[model samples]
Target: MEQTYIKKILKTRVYEVAKKTPLDYATNLSRRFNNHIWIKREDLQPVFSFKLRGAYNKMANLSEDILAKGVIAASAGNHAQGVALSAAKLKIPATIVMPKTTPEIKVAAVQSWGAEVVLHGTTYDDASKYAQQLVEQQGLSYIHPYDDEDVIAGQGTIGMEILHEHSGKLDAIFVPVGGGGLIAGVATYIKYLRPEVKVIGVEPDDAGCLHAALKAQERVILDQVGIFADGVAVRQVGKLPFEIARTHVDEVLLVNTDEICAAIKDIFEETRTITEPAGALALAGLKQFIARENCNGCHLITIASGANMNFDRLGYVTERTEIGEKREALMAVTIPERLGSFRQFCHAVGQHFITEFNYRYADDEKAYLFVGVRLNDGLEKDRLIAKLRDKEYPVIDMTDNEMAKSHIRHMVGGHTQSLANERLYRFEFPERPGALLHFLTRMGQRWNISLFHYRNHGAAYGRILVGIQVPDEQLNELQNFLENLGYPYWGEANNPAYQLFLN
Candidate 1:
């Protein structure tokens, strides 16, 4: 079976539209890790993504009769642009169905390529169903994004090129996986030719479809997936790609959104090019792998998968990169409300850069201060906390606290005594013009909103921290309301940060 892919990959027709991107050595990354780290520049392709290779190859293989009938595809973003450009090059009609929640930048890119864009439901699965229905009704051929043999073979060209460039020197190749097409193709080809080299798949921790499927020994659909790395947020791995990945991929690594953001910063520092979260996934995994294995002086390669980043998202990425890299520590400190207290706290912090400092005088005896200090690493944070403890200053580390990082840091004010039976919850929902209004309407004046904080981070989703007052007897009713709200939410009532500043 591996030999079959080997043969197919050798004959792939991706060259018609796809370029043989260079394998560029990352001198800075290599030096930092003490390993020879190289990046496969799939991001340099004309379409700014490797999806063009597979999309073009699959379209090229279709018969003239079938091509004349046109092709259709469903994608969140990258694949839609790939199919649209491929169809434009081949002078064939193409229709792309994309989720209505797709970023506006991506939707515009698909339209710019002259394809018929059909905005469908909220997720890829919904758009896929609509696209399949169109195939039967409109007499069009459907081009599966990652499930087809031809497409996998096309993506295999990257593996072939990597080997041709590096030969047998590479220790491992890290591939970003959504539905497993890229890793399936690369692993199949590499294992058949040079079985010694490892092929690893990387995924966002919140959207680890391939990792989950490989662990279960069969396909398993995720109940929910995070949208930060929207490009690779698939609920389920493709049937064929999952089978190949299960056999060939040596390991699967999961990286968090913050890690991905740090990787994007790493790439930008080296190349002056910002990558989307999914695009930086392989590098994020590579860093984690190097740390876990204590690998050094080894040759490693990771694919820079795509560069179709939304310009507005860079702010959110920058906000998390410092914490991701362990260069900053967020903390909450309680000090006596005295004239010399502020100076004492600053003296305790020493010469470390103060990135942020927020304090509001609440009580006559004590006050809580939300602060951020530059740190050399995680160990430095611990030492600082120890010093503060010796000085009898109560401190709570907020670096890893999601609520503290996302909302509470920006909101530090006097607590209200009039609000009784208050419960706090953080929610994430699709960001649209009337989305907040719709949510308020759904609440239907059942409970009073005691506290609320929201800021647009220019992401596809909106995050909000809401405090609602509900009696103990209405706990079941609150659960029912959240279930029907159709939005992801987490209770923060027990969070120390909330108790310290808001309660």
Candidate 2:
């Protein structure tokens, strides 16, 4: 069965539009990691992603009569562009159903490729359902983003190219997983051709569909997926890809948004090319794997999958990269509200660069300061925290705290003692025009919104920190409301970071 796929991969006619991207050695990354780091520059493709290979190959394999009927696909961005460009090149009409929450840049890109861009739903899964409906209604050929044999074979061509370019002993090859298409294809080829080369799949921790599926020994639908790495923010692993992945892929590594951001910085430093969060995922996973296994001097390969990033998203990436690389420390420190106290606190912090400092006069006795200080490494955070604690400053380490990182850092003022029965909850909803209003409307007038904070990270989903004044008697009602709201949320009422800074 594997041999048949190998043959199919060999015969994939992706070269009609897809370029054979280079396997460039990452010199700076290699030196830093003490390993031979090679990057498969798939981002250099015409569509700025590897999806074109699979999309074109899948469409190219279709009969001319079927092509005349046109094709339809549902994708957030990269895959949509792939299908659109492929259809344009083949002179086949294509209709791409994208989520309404998709970034405008991606929508414009798909439209530019001459595909009919239908904005629907709030997520790729939703768009997929709509696209499927069109496929049935119009008798259009549906080109799956992944899961198809021809598509997987087309992606497998990347593995073939990798092996051809670097036939040397490679310890591992890391591929970012979304629907498990890229990893499945690459892993199937690599494991068959070179069994010794560990084929690892990397996924965002918030969207660990592949990881969950692997653990469950079957494809499992995630309740919610993080849209930070939108290219790979799939709620469920593809059926066929998951099947292939389970058999061949060595491990699935979950990396956080910060780690992915850091990886993007790493790629930028080495190649001077900025990659999207999903594009840098494999590198982030490779770094984590190296640290966990303490392996060095080994040849490691990671695919830089795509560069179709919105220019605005860089702000969020830049903000998180330092913390991700252990080069920044965030803390909430309480000092006496006195002129001399500030001087002493700065003394304790020492010569470190202050990245952020937010303070408000709380009371006569004590004031809370939310601060970000630069650090050299992980040990520096411990030392800095220890120094602050030793100085008798009430210090709360906000490092690794999601609540602190996402909302509390920006919202440091207006802690209300008058607002009784206030419950804080962090919410994630599809980012669209009426999303927040829809949320507020569904919340109803029964509960008063005491506090609300929203920050756009240029992702498909919008994150909001909300404080609602709910009486103890209405706890069940609040639960019911949240359940019916159908949005991912977590009660941050008890979060220490919220208590330390925002409260």
Candidate 3:
């Protein structure tokens, strides 16, 4: 199977559209990590992603009859662009089925390649189902995003290029895993050639299909996946890719969204390139590996998979980068609600820079303040916590608290004792004009909105925290309303941060 894949990858016709991306050295990263760090610049491809390599390779291998009939694909992201461009280059009429929630920028990009775009369902699964129906109805060839053999081989060419460009003592190669095609292909080729060099797969901690599958020893579906890194938010790994990964892949590492954000900043510092969340997954994992293993003077390579980032999302990324890098600590401090309380707190803070502070009048006895403190290193958090304790100021570490960081930080308003039946919920919906209005309309004026907080992250989705007043008897009705609303939501009534500051 290895030799078969090797031969197929060697003969893959992806160059008809894909570029042989450079395995460029990362000078700044090397200096910081005290190792030779290199980045495979797959983001420089014509489609701004390595997806084109696999998409075009699969399309090119089709028989003339199949090619003449045109092709179809389902993606809300890079794969759609890859197939669109590939179809244009092959002079075939292509149709891409994307989720209705897909951002306008991506929809426009796919259309720019002269492909017919069909906006369907609200998720990749919906789009994929619609694409399958279209394929059956129109006799179009389906260009899968990452599950086919030819597609995997096409991606294998990346590994071939990496080895060809670098002849140094290579330690490990980090590849971002989505549906597993990229890592599957790269791992196969690299392991076959340089058996000693580790092939590590990186995945977002919230969307770790590959990591879960390896641990379970079988392909298992994730009940829910995070959409922050929309590119690799797959719930399940491909069957074939999982099989390849079971043996060929060395290790799989998971990094949180904050870690991924930090990696994006790191890549920009090293190469002046902005990459999508999934694109930075490998580098994030690489950084984690180095910090954990404490290895030095070893050659490490990370794939910069794609650069098709939503410009609006950069603000959110930048905001989280400091926390992700462990250079900032978010703390919840309690002080007496008196004139000199703030001054005393400031004295305790001393030389540490306060990056953020949020306080609202809650009660006369005590005041809860949400604060962000700059840290010189990761170890500073423990020391700062102790320092505040010594000053007799009660502090809670809110850096790793998702609810506090995502919603509470933006909302520090005092709790309302009047609204005793209020229920707190967090929701994520597609970002578009009138989206909030639509939500409100569906909510109907029956229930009183006691509290509401929302901030635009500039991504395809909008996150909102809502507190609605509903008696216990009407709880089921509220559930029914949320279900009919057709958006992802989480009940946060028991959230600790909300209790500490708001409730």
Error of 3 at 463 (Å): 0.7
Per-residue alpha-carbon lDDT of candidate 3 for residues 1-503, written as tens digits (9 for 90 to 100): 88999999999999888888898899989999898999999999988999999999999989999999999999998999999999999999999999888988999999999999999877899999999999999999999988999999999999999999997799999999999999989999999999999999999998999999999999999987888998999999999899999999999999998999999999999889999999999999999999999999989999999999989899999989999999999999999999999999999999999999998888789988999999999999999999999989999999998888888988887766666888999998777666788889998887999888887786768888998999899999999999998788899999878887888
Clashing residue pairs in candidate 3 are none
Question: Could you report the Cα RMSD, in angstroms, for every candidate shown?
Answer: 1.5, 1.4, 1.4
lDDT of 3 at 491: 92
Task: Give the TM-score of each candidate.
Answer: 0.97, 0.97, 0.97
Instruction: Give the worst 10-residue stretch by lDDT in candidate 3.
Output: 410-419
After TM-score superposition, what is the CA distance of residue 133 in candidate 2 from its true location, in Å?
Answer: 1.0
lDDT of 3: 0.92
lDDT for 186 in candidate 3 is: 96
- Highest lDDT model number: 3
Instruction: State how far residue 258 of model 2 sits from its true place (Å).
Output: 0.7
Comparing 1 with 2 on TM-score, the higher-scoring candidate is 2
lDDT of 2 at 126: 87
